[model samples]
Target chain A: MLTKRIIPCLDIKDGRTVKGINFVDLRDAGDPVELAEIYAKSGADELVFLDITATEQKRKTLAEMVRSVAEKVNIPFTVGGGISSIEDVDILLKNGADKVSVNSSAVKRPELINELSAKFGSQCITVAIDAKQVNGEWLVHLVGGKVPTDINLFQWAKEVEERGAGEILFTSMNNDGTKAGFANEALAVLSSELKIPIIASGGAGKIQHFTDVFLKGKADAALAASVFHFKEIEIKDLKEELRRNGVEVRL
Target chain B: MKIVIIDYGAGNIQSIKFAIKRLGFDAVLSSDAQEIKAADRVIFPGVGEAGSAMKMLKSTGLDKVIPELKQPVLGICLGMQLMCRHSEEGDTEGLGIFHADVVKFKTQLKVPQIGWNRIFNLKSELFEGIKEQEFVYLVHSYYVPECAETIASTEYGVEYTTAIQKDNFYGVQFHPEKSSDAGEKILENFLSSPSLLK
Candidate 1:
C-alpha cells in the first residue's frame, strides 16, 4: 500500500533556517542540514526547505545548503522559494536536491511550469499554489499570499497539472497561521479534480488535524512548519496516531 | 571496487553519488562507455521523458554498452523503466534488458503514484537484508507489469513489478537514494553482497 506522507517544512533565509526551532537535542537549531537529519531520523517521510532568502547570493547559498543537506540527510527533500528559472532548478538538482517547488514564478509565467517539467520531468517539478477563499471564490495569491489574482484556485491547479506539474502543493492562506484546521473542502475538491497528487499545506494544529487532512481533505501528503518545529506534535507519535485512525503511514 | 553511475544527461545523479558516498564508496558519473564498462558496478540512472532520455543514451552509445556489460548493473526509477522492452511514455522503446513493457497507470488512484510504498515477495539477493512490505519512495506514472524477471511487487491499483533482476542487471522502480534507511540498506546490499557478483 502507498502510505500517506508527513512532511516537515523549514524556512531558509540566506541558507540558514529561519524561525525558532524548539528541538532540545539540536546542537544548532538554525542549521537546516542538522535539522533535516534529525527530522529524517525522527520518522519524517519527506522534508521541504523553503528558501525565503532574497538576495543576489540567495541562489548560491541555497544551492550550497542543498548540497550539505543532501550529504547529511537520507530522505527526499524539496527546495522552494525564489526559484524562478531553469538555471536555478538545474543548480539545485545538480547539488542533489530531489525535487524543486515553484510558486509565484509559475503563476507569473505559466510557461515556466511547462518548461521545467519538459526539461526535468514532471516527477520533480512541484507547482505550489497559494490561495484564499473570498466570497465563495478561491482566488490564487502571489508573493507569499500577499497579492491576490482573479485566477480561480481550481482553474489554476488544473492548468498547472496540464502544464506537466507532477504534484500540487496547495497552501490555504486563510487557514495557515490559524491552526484551526485544514481547508479540507477545498483540498478534497482539488484532489478529485486533479490527477496529480495534492499536498495539503497551512492549517495543522493537532494530530486529529493531520488525520482529518488525510481522511477528510484526501491529501496525499500533509506539510507543516511550526507544529513539528516547536515539538507540539512529534512525528513518531503523530504517525502512530495516524495509523490508529486507519491512515496508512510509513512507521 | 570502482563504481560508475552512467550519466547520459538524464536527471539527478548527484543524490545517487551522495548515497554511495554515505556508504563509504565513491562513484563517478560518466557517459563514457569505457569508464562504465571498466567499473565493477554500474548504476544507470534516468529521471526525465523516456524518449529524450533514450535519445541521450543512444547519442552516447550507452544504449548498446549497458546490456553488454558483465558487471552488476543497477537501474533506478526511470532507469528501471528504460530497461524494459518498451514504454508507453513518449511511445519510446527501451534498452530491452528486462523483457517487459512499461505502461502507464490506468487506475483511479493517481497518475504519478508518489510517496512511500511497500515492496513484497522479495526474491532477489538485492533485497538481502530488506524485509518484505518495507516502504520505499516512488514517483512514476508508468510501471512494468509482473513478468518473469520480477523479484518484488508493489500494489497501487494493480500489482506491478517494483523490482526486477535478470542475470547481472538489477532494476528498482523506487528511488533507493531517497528512500531513507531501509533504502540505504538495499543499496548497501547491492554494493557489498558477494553473491550478487557474476
Candidate 2:
C-alpha cells in the first residue's frame, strides 16, 4: 500500500535555513543538514531542501550542504530553487536528493520537465506549483508567488502531469504563513484529477492540517515549513496522530 | 579498496558514485572491462529502458564480462532487472545470472509503481540490522517475481522481490543509494560482508 508522506521543507540560503514570512523576509533558522537530520530522525517521510536563493550566492553552498545532509541521514530528500537545467537536477539527485522539485525554472522552460523526465524518469522530477487564490480561483504563481502566471492552477497541473511529472507539490500562497490550514478545496480538486501523487504545501499550522489535507484534500503528502521548522509540531507525533485519525503511518 | 561502477550508458551513475562516497568509500565510474575486473566490487546501475541498456551493455562486450565477474557485483533497478533471466520491458533477454524473469506488475493501479513501499520476507544476510517490512524507496515499472534468490520481498499490489542474492551477485529492485540511511546500512553490510558461500 502507498503510505501518505509528511515532508518538511527548508528554504536554504547560503547553506543555512532561512524561513520567510510569505517568502519575503529571510531569517536564519539553523544549519540545513542538521535540521534535515533532525527531521529524518523524527520520521519525516521525506525532506525538501530548497536553495531558496540558489540563483545568487546560494549556488556554491548548495552542493556542500546537500553533501552534509546526505552524509547524516538515509531518507529521500529533494533540493529545489535555482535548478534551471537538467544538469542542475542531475547534480542535486547525485548529491543524495531523491527527487528534484522544480518551480520557477520549470515554469520558464516547460520542456525542461519533459527532458528531465525523459532522462531521469517522472519519478525523479517533481513540479512544485506555488498558487495563490486570486478572484476565488486558484492562480498559478511563479518566482516564489511574487509573479502570477496567466495559467490556471488546475490546467497547468494537468499539463505537467501529462508531461510525466511524477508528483505535484501544490502550495497555497494565501494561507502559506497564515497556518490556518491547507487549501483543501484546491488540493482535493487537483488530487482527484491527477493520477500522480499530489503533495499539499502551505497553510499547515497544526496536526489536524495534515489530516485535513489527507482526508479532506485527498493529498498523498502534506508539506509544512514553519510548523515543523519551528519545532512546534513534531513530525513523529503528527504521524501518530494521523494514524489514530485513520491514516496509514510507517510506525 | 575502490569500487568501480559500470556505466552502461543507462543509469544515474553520478548519484551512485555520490552515494558510495557518502558511505566513506571511493567509487570509480567505468565502462572499461579492465577497470571493472580490477575493482574491489562492480556496481551495475541502470535507469533507462531494458532493451536499450542491453544494447549498450553488449556494445562494450560488458554483458559477457559481467556474468563472468568473480568479484562481488551489485545491480540496482534496471541493473538488477538485467541480471535476471528475462525482462518484459522490451522483451530483452537478461544475463541469466539469477533464475528469474522481470515482468511488469499486471494490476490495474498503474504501469510504474513509483514512491516508497515496505519490504518484508528478508531471508539473507543482506538485511543485518534492518527489520522486516522496513520501508524502502522503490520506483520501478517491472518487477522480478518470486525466485529462489530473493533476499527481501516488498508488497505493492502483491508481494514482489525487493532484493535478491545469488552466489557472488546481488540485485535490488529498490535503489539502496536513494533509499536513505536504512538503505545505506544495507549497502555498508554488502561492502563489509562477503557472501556466505564465498
Candidate 3:
C-alpha cells in the first residue's frame, strides 16, 4: 500500500520564497535549491513549488528556479501558478518538474486538464482547487481565492476526476492563512467521493493536523508551509507524531 | 578517478549524485564518449519513455559507448529496463544487454506500484551483506519478468525480477539511491566489487 505523503509547498517569488517574520532558518530558506535539499533531508514525502509571483517575465525565471531545486532534490515535485497550456506543462516537466498543477487556468478553461492529461498520463496532471466556506457550504474559489465560483466543491472535484486529473490538491482558503487545522469535514466528503488520491492543503498549525487529515479526512497526503518554513514544526518530529497516531507514514 | 554517469537523456540525475556522495564516491554526469571511456565506472540512469530514451541514447551515441565500457557499469530503474531486450512502455525497443522484455505489471493492484516492496530470491555478490526477503523501495509500472540474469525478485501483484546481473553489467529495478541502507550497501558493493573493474 502507498503510504501517506507529507508535502511542504514553497511559494517562490523572484527566485526567493517569502515567509513572514524572517529568521535564520527562513532567511536562507528563501534560496529554492537550498530549501529543497533541506526538506528532502527532513523527510518530506514530496514538494510543491507554487509560482505565485506570476508575470509575463517571471515564467522563464520560474523554470530556472525549478531546475535549481530539481538539482538538489530527487523526490517528486509539483509546480503550479501561471501555467495555462500544454506547452507550459511540457517545458516544466522537461526541465525536471514531475507534475504540473493547474488552478486558475483550469477554472477558466477546464479542458486544459483533459488535454494535458491526454498527452501526458493522468499521473502527470494535478488539479488544485481553492475552496472556502460560504454560509455553511464550501464553495470553490479561483485566482488565488479572490473570486468565487458557482460550482460546488464536491461537484467540481468529481468533475476534475472525470477530466483525467491524477490527483486533486484541495486547499481550504478560510484556513489558508490561519493555520488552525485542515478542514477535515470538507476533506472527508471529497475523499469519499473521488477515486484519485487527494492531497489536503491549508490550515496546518501543528503536526497533528496532518495525522488528522490522513486518519479522519482520508487524505492521501497533508501539505503545509509556514510551520515548516519558520521551523515551527520539524518534519521528522511531525512524522513521529503521525506514526504515534497510527497513520502509516514513511519516516 | 571521476565516475561517469551516462546521460542518455532519461530522468533526473541529482538523486544518483546525492546517493554517490553520501557513499563517499565522486560521480560525473556525461554522455560524451571520450569522458565515459576514461572513467573508472559508468552509471546509466533513465526514467521516461523507453523507446525515446533509447532513441536519445542512440542520438547521443551513448548507446554504442555504454555497452562497450571496460569499467563496472550499473543501471537504475528505467536505466535497467532500457538495458534489457525490450519494454512494454511506449512500445519501445531496448538495448539487448539482458535477454528479457520489460512487461507491464498486471493491473491487479495499481498501474504504478509506487511504494516500498520486498525483494526475495536474492543471488550474487550484490546481496553479499543483504539478507533474503529484505524490503527495497520501488515505483515502477513495468518490470522485467524473471530471467536467467535475475539477481533479486520481488512481487507486487505477481513475482517479477527486481534486479539483474550479467558480467560487468548490473541492473536494479528499485532505486538504490532512494532505498536507504540496503541501497547504500548495494551501491558500495558495486563500487568495491573487484571483478567488474576488469
Candidate 4:
C-alpha cells in the first residue's frame, strides 16, 4: 500500500532560501534548515532543496546548508540544481540527501544516469525533465528552461527509464507560473508509458490541482515551489483535502 | 553505548547516522572488521545491487565477520536481502544468516515498490511498542518470502517477509532511518530492547 507523496520544493540562492517565504514564522523560515524543520513538522512526506546558485563559492554554501538540514530533519530530502558530476552527487548524498535530481547535465550525457545507477543504485537518482510544448509537441528544455532541445518528452522519458533512472520529475514550463492547473493530459501519458514513478511538477495552484494530478494525471508525487513557499496553499490543509478526495496520502 | 554502521560503499549511510544521533547515540561509520566487532550494536545497511555489495564484503572480509558476530546485528534493505540464503537480483548468494530466499516480485504490480507501507504480523523485539499497521518507508525491487525466520510481514502484491529474526541477528527490508516517528521507535527498540541486549 504505497501512498502518493506530497513534496514541497525550496529553491536556494546564495545559501539562503529564495522566493520570499511568507509563513507564520517568517523569521525562522529564512534559514533553509529552519524552513525544512517547519515542513517536516507539517507532515511533508519529502522535501526537495534546489540550489539555484551558479557560483562555485555559493555551491559550497549549498553543501553546508544541506549538511545543516540533514542534521535537523529526519525525513528523506532531495538536493538538485547545478549537480553535474559524480563528485556533486557524492557530496550531497554524504550530506544526507535521499535522492539527487539531474536535469541539464543528464540531458547532455545520458550515460551519467547509467554510471550513477551502477555506482549508487537507481533509487538514488531522479531524472528531472523540464519540458515546454512547442507547436503542440512537448520538447525537452535545459539551462533552467532557457534552452530547448529537439528531444521529445515521451521518448526521452522512456530512454531515461531504460538508462536505469529510478523516477522521473516532469515539469511543464507552459503551466509553471500560470498555476491554472497541471498538465494532466501529458502527465497521464507519462504515467501510462513508464513503469517508474512520475512526479508532476511546475503548475500546482490550488488544492484541487494536487488531487487532479494524483487522480487525473496519475502522478506518483506532486512537487511545487511558490504555492507552498508563499503559503498560498498549506501542506497540512492540502493533504487533508487530498485524503478526503480518496487519495492515499500520509496523515 | 557505541553504534557502528557498516559502510561498504553503500548509499544513504548518512541518514542512518543522523537517525542514531537523534536517538542520543554516537554512530561510527566504518568498514573495518575490528571496529564493527568492537561496537555494542552494529547496523548493516545497503542501497545497491547485491552481487557487487557481497563482493566488497568478501574482499574486505566483512562477510565472514558479520555472521560470526554475537552482538546484536541489524540488516536493512539490501543488507537484509544479503543476509538471506540467495537473491534473484544478480543471482547472487547471500551471507546465509537467515534461512530465506530473496526473489523478484512476479506480479502485475510495479517493479520497484516505493513509498511508505504498513507492516503487520509483528512478533519480534525490534517492533516493541510499535503498533500494527504502522507505516514504514520501503524502496526495493525484490523481497524475502515468508518463512520460519520471518518475524514481521506485510501485504503488497502478496504477503512477504518484511522483517526477520534468528537468534541475535535481525533484518528489515524497510528504511527505518527515513520512516519518521514509527521508524525512529523501531531503532530505539533495537538499541534498548532488553532481550537483544542479552
Candidate 5:
C-alpha cells in the first residue's frame, strides 16, 4: 500500500535555515543538512527545502546546501523557490536533489513546465500553486502569495498536470498561518480533478489536522513548517495517531 | 570492490553515488564500456523516458555492454524497467534481461504513484534483513507485473513486482537511495554481499 507521506518543509536562506527551529539536540539549528537528517531519522517520509534567498549567489548557496543535505540525509528531498530555468534544476539534480518544485516561474512562463518535464521526466518535476479565495473565486497568487493573478487555481493546476508535472503542491494562502486546518474542500477538488499527486500545504496545527488533510483533503502528502519545527507535534507520535485513525503511514 | 554507476545521462545518478558513500563505499560515474565492465559491481540507473534513455545507452554502446556483463548488476527505477523485455513508456523495447514487460498503471489511482509503499513476499538476498511489508519510496508511472523472476511485490491498486532477480542481474522498482534506513540497508546488502551474485 502507498502510505500518505508526512513532510517537514524547511525554509532555506543564503544556504542556511532561516526559520526558528526548536530542535534542542540539533548541534546547529541553522544547518539545513543536520535538520534534514533529524527529520529523516524521526520518520519524515520526505523533506522539502524552500530556498527563500534573494541574492546573486543564491543558486550557488542553495546548490551547496543541497549537496550537503544529500550527502547526509538518506530520504528523498525536493528543492524549490527561485528555480526558474533548466540549468538551475539541472545543477540542483546533479548535486543530488531528487525533485525540484517550480512556482512563480511556471506561472510566468507555463511553457517552462513543459520544457522541464520533457527534459527531466515528469517524475521529478513538481508544480507548486499558491492560491486564495477572492470574491468566491480561487485566484492564483505569485511572489509568495503577495501578488494575485486572474488565473484560476483549478485551471492552472489542471494545465500543470496536462503539461507533465508529476505532482502538485497546493498552498492555500487563506489557511497558511492560521493553524486552524487545511482547505480540505479546495484540496479534495484538486485531488479528484488531477491524475498526479496533490500535496496539501499550510494550516496544519495539530495531528488531527494532518489526519484531516489525508482523510478529508485526499492529499497524497501533507507539508507543514512551524508545527514540526517548533516541536508542537512530533512526527512519530503523529504517525502513530494517524495509524490509529486508520490512515496508512510509513511507521 | 570497484563500483561503477553506468551514467549515460538519463537521470539523477548523484543521489545513488551519495547513497553508496553513506554506506562507506565509493562509486564512480562512467559511460565508458571498459570502465563499467572492469568494475566488480555495476549500478544501472535511469530516471527519464525509456526510449530516450535506451537511445543514450546505445549511443555509448552501453545498451549492448550491460546485458553481457558477468558482474552483479543492480537496476533501479527506470533502470529496472529497461532491464525487462519491453516498456509501455515511449513504446520502448528494453534490454531483455528479465522476461517481464513494463506497463503503465491503469487503475483509478494517481498516474505516477509517489511516496512510501510496502514491499512484500521478499525472495532475494537483496532484502535479506528487510521485513515483509516494509516501506520503500517509489515514483513512477510504469511497473513490471508479477513474473517468475519477481523477488518482491508491492500494491498500488494492483499487485506488481517491486524487485526482480535472474542469475547475475537484480532490479528494484523503488529508489533505495531515497528510501531512508531500510533503503540504505538494501544498498549495503547489494554492495557487501557476494551471495547476491550466486
Candidate 6:
C-alpha cells in the first residue's frame, strides 16, 4: 500500500532558515541543514527547502545548503523557490535534491514545466501552484502570491499533469499563515480531478488539520512549515495520531 | 569494500552514493566498465525514459559490460526495468537478465504509483533482516510481472514483482536510498551479504 506522506517545509533565506524555529534540541534555528537533519530524525517522510533568498549571490548559498543537506539527510528532499530554468533544476539535482518545485516561473512560462519535466523525468519535477479563491474561483497567483493570474487553478493543474509533472503542490494563499485549516474543499476536488498525487500546502495549523487534509481533503500528502518548524507538532507524534485515525502512514 | 554505481547521466545517482557512504562504505559513481566490473558490488541506478537511458548505456558500451558483470549488481527503479527482457516504455529492449517484460500499469489508479508500498512473501538474502510487508519507497509507471525471478511482490492495482534475483543479479523497483531506515537495512543487507563478498 502507498502510505500517505507527511512533509515538513523549511523556508531558507540567505542560506539560513528564515523562521525562528524554536525546537529545544535544534539550537541553531538559523541553519537549514541542521533543521532538516532534525526533521528526518523526527520521521518526516520528506522535506522541502524553499530558497527564500532573493539576491543572486545568496542563491549560490542556497545551493551550498542543498549540498550539505543532501549529504546528511537520507529521506527524499525537494528544493524550490527561484527555480525557473533547466539550469536551476540541474544545480539542485546535482547537489542531490530528489525533486525540484517550480511556482512563479512555471506560471510565467507554462512551457517551463514541460522543459524541466522533459530534461529530468516528470518524477523529479514538482509544479507548485500558489492559488487563492477570488470571486468564488481559485485563481493562480505569481511572485509569491503578490499577483493573481487569469489562469484557473484546476485548468493549470490539469495542464501541468499533461505536461508531465509528477506531483502538484497546491498552496491556498487565502488559508496561508491563517492556522485555520487546509482548503479541504479545494483539495478534495483536486484529489478527485487529478491523476497525480496532490500535496496539500498552506493552512495546516494543528494535527487534526493534517488528518482532515488526508481524510476529508483526500490529499496524498500534507505539508506544513511553522507547525513542524516550531515544537508545536512533532512528526513522530503526528504519525502516531494519523495511525490511530486509521491512516496508512509509515510508522 | 568497493561499490560502483553505474552512472549513465540519470537522476538520483548522488542520493544512492550518499546512501552507501552513510552505510560506512565508499561508493564510486562511474561509467567506466572496468571500475564497475572490478568493484565488489555494483548498483545500476537510473531515473528517466527507458529508450534514452538504454541508448546512453549502449553509447557508453555499458550495456555490454553490465550484463557480463560477475559481481552482485543491484538495479534500482528504471535501472531495474532496463534489466528486464523488454519494456513497454518506448518499446525498448532491455539487458534480458530478469527474463520478464516490463509493462505499463493500466488501471483506475494513478500511472506512477509514487510513495512507500509494502513488499511481502520475501525471498533471497537481499531481504535478510527485513520483515514481511515492510515498506520501501517506489516511483515508477512500468513494472515487471510476477515471474520465477521475483523474490518479492507488491500490489498497486495488480500483483507485480517489486524485487527480483537471478544468480548474481538483483533488482528493486524502489529507491532504497530514499526509503529511510528500512531502505538503509536493504542496502546494508546487499552490501554485507556473503554471496556479494568475494
- Tens digits of per-residue lDDT, candidate 6, A106-190, equal 8788899888888889888889999999999999999888898999999999999999999999999999999999999999999
Which stretches of candidate 2 lie above 4 Å from their native place?
A20-29, A54-58, B9-11, B14-24, B90-93, B106-112
Compared with the true structure, the alpha-carbon lDDT of candidate 5 equals 0.94
Clashes of 3: 0
Candidate 5 chain B weakest ten by summed lDDT: B189-198
Top candidate, metric DockQ: 5
For candidate 4, the share of real interface contacts preserved is 0.60
- Expressed as tens digits, the lDDT of each residue in A1-251 for candidate 4 is 77899899998998788878888775776699889888888888889988889786965787788888888887888889978889899888888888999989999999999998888888889999999999999999998899999999999999999999989999999989888889999999999989888989988889999999999999998999888888899888998999999998877
User: How big is the positional error of residue B148 in model 1, measured in Å on the Cα after superposition?
Assistant: 0.9
**Model 4: per-residue Cα lDDT over B1-198, one tens digit each:** 878999988777888998889999899999998998998899999998999999999999899999999899999999999999999999999999999999998866656777778899999989989999888888888999999999999877899999999998999999889888889999999988888894
Assess every candidate by TM-score.
0.99, 0.89, 0.78, 0.97, 0.99, 0.98
Given candidate 1, what's the lDDT at residue A153?
98
* Model 6 docking category: medium
lDDT of 1 by residue, A166-246 (tens): 999999999999988899999999999999999999999999999999999999999999999999999999999999999
> Who is ahead in DockQ, 3 or 6?
6
Distance from true location, Cα of A69 in model 3, Å: 2.9
Residue A223 displacement (Å), model 2: 1.0
Higher-TM-score candidate of 2 and 6: 6
Q: Evaluate candidate 2 and give its CAPRI docking class based on DockQ.
A: acceptable
Ranking by DockQ: 5, 1, 6, 4, 2, 3
Better of 1 and 4 by DockQ: 1
Worst ten-residue run, lDDT, model 2 chain B? B189-198
Give DockQ for candidates 1 onward, in order: 0.90, 0.43, 0.21, 0.72, 0.92, 0.76
Candidate 5 clashes between residue pairs 3 or more apart in a chain or in different chains: none
Q: What are the runs in model 4 whose C-alpha is more than 4 Å off? A: none
Candidate 5 DockQ vs. native: 0.92
lDDT of 3 by residue, A1-251 (tens): 34677888988888778655234664564688888877877778778988878576677888888776665565677899879998788778766676789998998899998898766656668899999999988889998999998889999999998998878899999888787899998998888887677889999998777888888888878888888888899889988888898876666
Please report how far candidate 6 places residue B45 from its true position, in Å. Answer: 0.7
lDDT, candidate 6, at A174? 95
**Runs of candidate 1 exceeding 4 Å displacement:** none
